[model samples]
Target: MSTSPRLKTQDTKARDAEYQALWQACDRASRKQEYLCSHHEAKRIILESACHGILDKRRGQGKIMCGTSIVSMVHLHLQRDVNSRLLAEARMSRFPSPPPNDMPCLANPVANAGNPVGYNDIPQQQQQPQRVSPMISAAEMALRNEVTSLRQDVSLLRQEHELVVSSLQILTERVAKLEGRQAVLEAYPNQGIEGRNAWMLVKPMSPRSQTQGRDEDMVNKAADF
Candidate 1:
């Protein structure tokens, strides 16, 4: 093996060792999976992997760095789902199963004296042994898993997009408010502090210089807007 490859292998192993605790916690997610980390950390890891020719985005693959510590796009929704399922199971176990209702077969021939027996009157639940759940083939199961994974990814992306849009809207509203205030300043030149008597106490500029200063300030403020 190449010296660089050997070094990279060692580095990957070391990073894996650092995240052993995270993996162990994911084995039994108490609240949620710790797989998703901060963007700053993701960028550092991604850039480093790219430097080492490990970020293979040329071909269609599940992850850019699957075997390494650089799992930027890795969303462990399955782990969290499994944890929730287990928790639900535990909660369900605490309750006793409800007894089968001894409901009278209203459609029974005997109920109406000479009425014909309806299929609904039959005790199908008691007669028929509980049917086992449908078994999924390997291919179908694989497809289902892939679909689930894609759904989780889509959900995560949508959440991020919503947050970005909300932040942008808030920023735009703030800018609009600032622009409205600045418009008032631009509308009335005489109302400005620079032309007031108190302005002389701060900076006693000549009339020409004061006018020029005000013009420059207006230009700068408009440019900012």
Candidate 2:
């Protein structure tokens, strides 16, 4: 069941080659002035494709990659020449901002007995408030609202579809029942008006006709059979 190191190395090289191809594709897409997607979008597509390939390969090999490992792989492959520190900072920003300065850090009471903490002893770094574009915020809000509306619309449409299907099913059952009655009536031609009425209910269009001649002929044939 053990895999050879040579085979492992070959697999690793093949994976790296695939990622390189994805990077090349992103670069080519960026160079195309007429490309419909933006540079970031192209990069996103390449990353997604590469991730999907990795996932499929992992499944085939019966191996599972940890979430952090997968994320690290994606970051490494996509931003090969980018600063690792910058990427770390970007990821940190995605999490909840650090607790306010007033919040106390957890420490052993016994260890801090002789050394009382003070604001003067604390380190202070100049912090700048990050500015967000109003247009981008507005667009994001609009998109969220649009997504909510679409979800509601989809639910309503699905309910309507179910209702239509149920109604058709009921109609089908009724038609089958009417057909069974018609068959019985045909076997006994002298069954009377009730049988004829059942047939009329099943085929309602017979009563509302542009041609009386055709309708009469149909009724006569039914009565004869």
* Each candidate structure's count of clashing pairs: 0, 0
In model 1, what lDDT does residue 196 have? 50
* lDDT (Cα, tens digit) per residue for candidate 1, span 60-173: 343323344434222343435447658756754554445566665556556565546542433535444444445555356446555665676799899999999999999999
Measured by lDDT, the strongest candidate is: 2
User: Mind sharing the TM-score for model 2?
Assistant: 0.27
Best by TM-score: 1
Candidate 1, residue 193: how far the Cα is off, in Å? 9.3
Q: After superposition, how far is residue 83 of candidate 2 from its true place, in Å?
A: 40
**Reference-based TM-score of each model:** 0.32, 0.27
Q: Which ten residues in a row have the lowest lDDT in candidate 2?
A: 29-38
> How displaced is residue 69 in candidate 1, in Å?
11
RMSD of each: 21.1, 23.5
